[model samples]
Target: MESLVVPVLILLAVVAGVTVAYRAARKRKTGRPASQAEPAKAPQELARAAADRLSEDEHRRVYALIAQGQAMAAIKLYYEITGEGLRASRDAVGALAAHPQPFRRQEPAQAVEEDDDEPQRFPYRYRAIASKGDVTREVSSNMLNDEIYGRIRTLARSGDTEAAANALTRHSDISLTQAREFIALLDD
Candidate 1:
């Protein structure tokens, strides 16, 4: 019992000493001298450049997408193509689709001219809600662009003319007349 008591006390003393030393070392490493501290920049000044580069609407959109936890790769690709970052673009898209009152509404459609002179076309938002039997599918503009073109060509080659025409009309931003003309050309 005496031998065990001494060994236990010695072990406790050693542990306490090591703990004190470790804590003291950590404090010494972390505690910077007053002269060594770096000066802080103003938050407004720090954010100014990023703010200037992106509009308020863009910022809101990006932050909202980020909040929604979108994949970084998809966001990066979107940002690369569009000037807006992934988060912002996602937020903007969501706002456009879901919000009752949008912060920025798209401009009115311009008159189509016969001549070569054409105004910039604003990105269109398309949502197709289709129900077949019990299954309902909601297709968005982005999904249509990504998958419809190839599907349309395949369907057309397979002699599924109706399906191809429907797919082309659903995918394209052009009028039904224009889509029909294009699909007719596919036959030729």
Candidate 2:
């Protein structure tokens, strides 16, 4: 038994080394990652966006499917209604399940305009929030990207609150008074 100890120790060390090398090589051969990635939208914001893509009846059915623990059915329903790819529909369903968002009427124009350059559809959504004291306001829309939001912020910071409010209302579904209230917090 004593004579076999050294050989057994060497065998174990060799096996460990081979296993480590195999894992390292496997990690290097993974599928290629996305070439470009947009900043992630908030999960609740995404849930709201997903819900907004559905019409009233579709929304009810999708939520019902989700409540019944039928994830695939919910995803399928969302995909059929929104015409999104399988992966996006799955992700949207997951987000919706994790965070329940209120149903706001989605404009038809806002739903299909994500692709501007080559007419590809994108599921990205944006949400802007402002709060002062006990008052808070939120704006969610597909039309409000980071650049547009930055411009609105710049306009507000430059003392052009009215123009900022106008721009906010143009990109979001909020009313002018609500936009003004939202803009006021950003000026600080």
Candidate 3:
């Protein structure tokens, strides 16, 4: 037993060293100790508002991780990016992946500080899908619903595609080009 003491002591010391290094690295990366708890975040449920919160690059990154089937990693990334609660991050990632959102440039009137010009914010998000051959696109937004989408579709079928595309862009986060592409699929 006396002869075995040195090797066991060395092994314990190595393990303790590794543990300390790992924790220090984690603290440096996250700006908090590994054992520290995260504070509560705003918005319990992720609506279209989640898409509104993430920047274009961050939105793409989260979706890419989800597409690669790394849900846990995506959740962790979204949690870090948005500083949202773990549960909210998970839900946001799931929602964002299921219905991909294109980045919409924020209009001056849409700022949160203004009360009067703020467009209506919805609790639920709506999805409208259009496909031509193997190419498919989806527009998901809180500003759209079944009745509104039907009207847009009617505008497309009536040979008023430009108007329809404009309406789609108004309702969703997609750009004019993307809205036109989506409208092309609906033109039939």
- Candidate lDDT values, in order: 0.53, 0.83, 0.82
Index of the highest-lDDT prediction: 2
Q: Give lDDT for model 1.
A: 0.53
Runs off by more than 4 Å, candidate 2 = 1-36, 107-188
Which residue pairs overlap in candidate 1's backbone? 61-88, 62-87, 62-88
Error of 3 at 63 (Å): 68
Model 3: per-residue Cα lDDT over 133-177, one tens digit each: 999989999988787789889999999999988888877789999
Candidate 2 lDDT over residue span 20-72, tens digit each = 88776666665332333356788888898898888788888999999999999
What are the clash counts of all predictions, listed in order?
Answer: 3, 0, 0
Ranking by TM-score: 2, 3, 1
- Model 1: residues with Cα > 4 Å off, grouped in runs: 1-19, 26-146
Candidate 1 lDDT, tens digit per residue, 1-188?
88799999999999999988887776677695444555643444433433344455765654465566653543553366467766664443444334323234445599655221222322765454434455454444542543445566577678886776666555645556655445555543
TM-scores of the models, in the order given = 0.28, 0.39, 0.37
Cα-based RMSD of the predictions, in order?
Answer: 18.7, 20.8, 19.0
Against the true structure, whose TM-score is highest? Answer: 2
- Candidate 1 lDDT for residue 26: 68
Candidate 1, poorest ten consecutive residues by summed lDDT? 113-122
